[model samples]
Target: MKFTLLLFPLLALALRSQPRSRTGVTEHVTLNLRPGISLETTNAGAQDWIFQIVGKWSGFQDGHWGLELGDAPTAVYWFFNWDSVASHQEFTRSPEYPATIEKVESLASSFSAPHVPLQPFPPREVFASPVVSWVTFNLTGVANSTATTNWQATANDFLGNLTRVSGYRAHSSGWEVEDSRVFSVLVGWESAESLGAYVISRSFAEGFRRLVSGVAWEHRVLRVAGYVPKL
Candidate 1:
C-alpha cells in the first residue's frame, strides 16, 4: 500500500503537466460604492473574518495599465479570459472560506451598486486570439469632457501606429471628480513579445509621454495579471 501510494503523486504529475501554459485565467472586475467611500480602512479590517475566499486571486499579471486615476474611483476592474463564474462560486461555497459572510456584514453600510453587470462574453469574432477581456474604472476627478477627449485622441493616435500587436480595443468608463481626476485603462497583449514591441517601439513611447505630461498625480502604481481559462 505504501509503494502504491508513493506512485500516485507521480502519476498525477505526469497527467497534469502542460509546458505550453504561460498565462493565468483573465477576470474583469469593477467596484463602485455610492458617492463618498473607500474600502482600505474599514472593510478589509475586522476581528472575526470567516468567509471570504482569500487564496490564489492573482488572475491577470500579464496585462498593462494604460490610463490614470480618477477623482474617487468611479470604477475598479480586472479583465481577462477567466475559467468561468462557476470557479468563483466554487471558491465561495467551499467549507474553508473566510471572507464570505464577514465582508457582507462589515461592508453593509459602505457598499452600493447601481450596476451589477456580470454577463458572459458573447460569442463574437475577435482578432486572432485565444481569449480577451476589458476592464473599466472611474478616476474620480477626470470626468471633465474636454481634457479626456483630447487625451483619448492623442493616445489613440500613438497606439494606432504601434505595429505587430493583436487584440487591441479601447473603452472609456466615466470618472467621479470627488475621488480622482483621471481614469485608468487596462489593455491586453497576446504574448510577451507583443508587449516588448510596444514598449521599445518609439512611436508608442513618444505618444505616451505626451499624454502623461498633461495629468500629474501623486502616489501612483500599476497592477497587472495574466490569465488562461482551463475550461
Candidate 2:
C-alpha cells in the first residue's frame, strides 16, 4: 500500500473559470480523533449529527464523510455542499448547532472547517463512489501571477489525464478563499485497489515528476471510503 513514487501529489490551482447559475460552496471539515477513540465510534456520532442537519437544514445539498487512510489516519473528513457561506453561517447560529458540536467534540481532539467554491460544482455521484481521494497542495513560496498561470496549466493537464484512467468516476477542484495558496481536489474512484494500481503505474510516476519539479510545495493525499448516511 506504500509506494514512494506513487505517493506523489496531484493537482494545484483552480480549474478553468466558468459561469454558474447559482452561488455554491463546498465545506471541507477535518476532525482529528482523540487518542484511543475509534473511527467507528466517531463515525456513528458524526453521522447522527449530519443526518439531523441534512434533514432540517434547507441549504444542505449533499455530503461525503469518511475516515482518512494512510499516514495520519486518525482523522475524519467531511465535504458538504451548501447553498452559500451565509447559509452555513446561519446553520451555525441555529439552536441545534451547540448540541451537535457537543456530541462530536468528545471523539475529536481538534478540527478545522474551511470552505471553497468549486467551479462547475461536483455532482452527487462523485462522492457516491466507493472511494474518494482528497488532496491538498500548499504553495511553498510566493505565488506570482506568472507562476500561478504556469502551475494552472500543468495542474489542469494532470487532472485531465486522471479522468482518462479506468475506474475514475469524477473529479472536482478549487482553491480555498481564506488562503489562496491552498488548493484542494476531490477525485472519486470505483475502489481503492484501482487507485493504488494507477498510482504505481509508469504514467503516474512521469506525470507526478512533471507536476512537482522545481515547484516548491507540500501536499497530502488521503484515501477515504465514501460515507452515505441512511436517511
Candidate 3:
C-alpha cells in the first residue's frame, strides 16, 4: 500500500474527544560508540549493565534500545518511558545510577539524554517493531500559537497519509520539553526497506515538503534488535 497526501481539515476536531495527556516523560538517549567498538560489543555490554537496571528503577514504564541503521551505524538509540520527570530524577539518585552511567560511558565516546513528554506515548508494539524511525524538526523561530496550529494541521495531514503506507506500524510525536521549538516523531515500520520506499514516494515527498517547509530536521532509522526486559 502507498500513502497519498490529502487534507483532512476536520482531523483535529475528530481527535478532540480523545484526550491526550502529557503527564509521562520519554527519555531519548543517543550513544556514539567509541572507536574500534563494534555494535555487538556494545549490545553485549548493555545486557550486562544498563539493561539489567530496568525494573529496578521506579516509574520506569517501558524501554527500547537498539543499534542505529543508515548514517550513524555505530550509534545506539535508547528510549525510556517514565511516569514523569520527577520519577526519572528520582532514579538518578539511586545507587545503581552511577554504575549504569559508568558502564554506558565506557562503551560510548559521547552521549546525550534528552527528556520530552511525547504526547500520546507510543505503545509497546512500536518499539517491538523490526525497524523504528526517529525524526526531529527544529522550528525556524519561536513557535507562537499560530505556527503551532499550522504545524499540527500539516502533521495530521501527513500522518493520515502515513498510516496507509505498507509496513507502517505505529507513531507518536511531541515537542522537546527543554526546547519547545524542537519537535520529534517516532515511527515503527516492518523494515527499513519499507520506510525507505515510503520516503521516496510521492506521498512522502509532498507531505514532508509541507511539513518541514522552512524547518530544519533530521532522522535516523534503527534496526530494533531487542527490547528492555524482553517485552
lDDT digits (tens) for residues 121-183 of candidate 1: 211222123222333333234447786777668656654554344434322222221223434
What is the descending TM-score order? 3, 2, 1
Give lDDT tens digits, candidate 3, residues 1-231.
011112122222322322343368788878777776665654586555677685567678878877888654778778888777667666666777666666766677666666678866744667868999998888856368798788878887787777799999988888776566878888889988899899999888988998888788888888887666522
- Write candidate 2's Cα lDDT for 124-162 as tens digits: 666767677776666656458788778778889999999
Those runs of model 1 whose alpha carbons end farther than 4 Å from true positions after fitting are 1-145, 162-180, 217-231
Q: What lDDT does the true structure give each of the candidates?
A: 0.34, 0.67, 0.72
Error of 2 at 47 (Å): 3.4
Ranking by lDDT: 3, 2, 1
- Can you tell me which runs of candidate 3 are displaced by over 4 Å? 1-22, 39-43, 70-72, 140-143
Q: How accurate is candidate 2 locally (lDDT)?
A: 0.67
Considering lDDT, which of the candidate structures 1 and 2 is the better prediction for this target? 2
Pairs that collide, model 3: none
C-alpha RMSD by candidate, in order: 17.2, 8.3, 10.6
Winner by lDDT between candidate 3 and candidate 1? 3
TM-score, prediction 2? 0.78
Cα error, residue 57 of model 2, in Å, equals: 1.5
Q: What C-alpha lDDT does candidate 1 achieve relative to the native structure?
A: 0.34
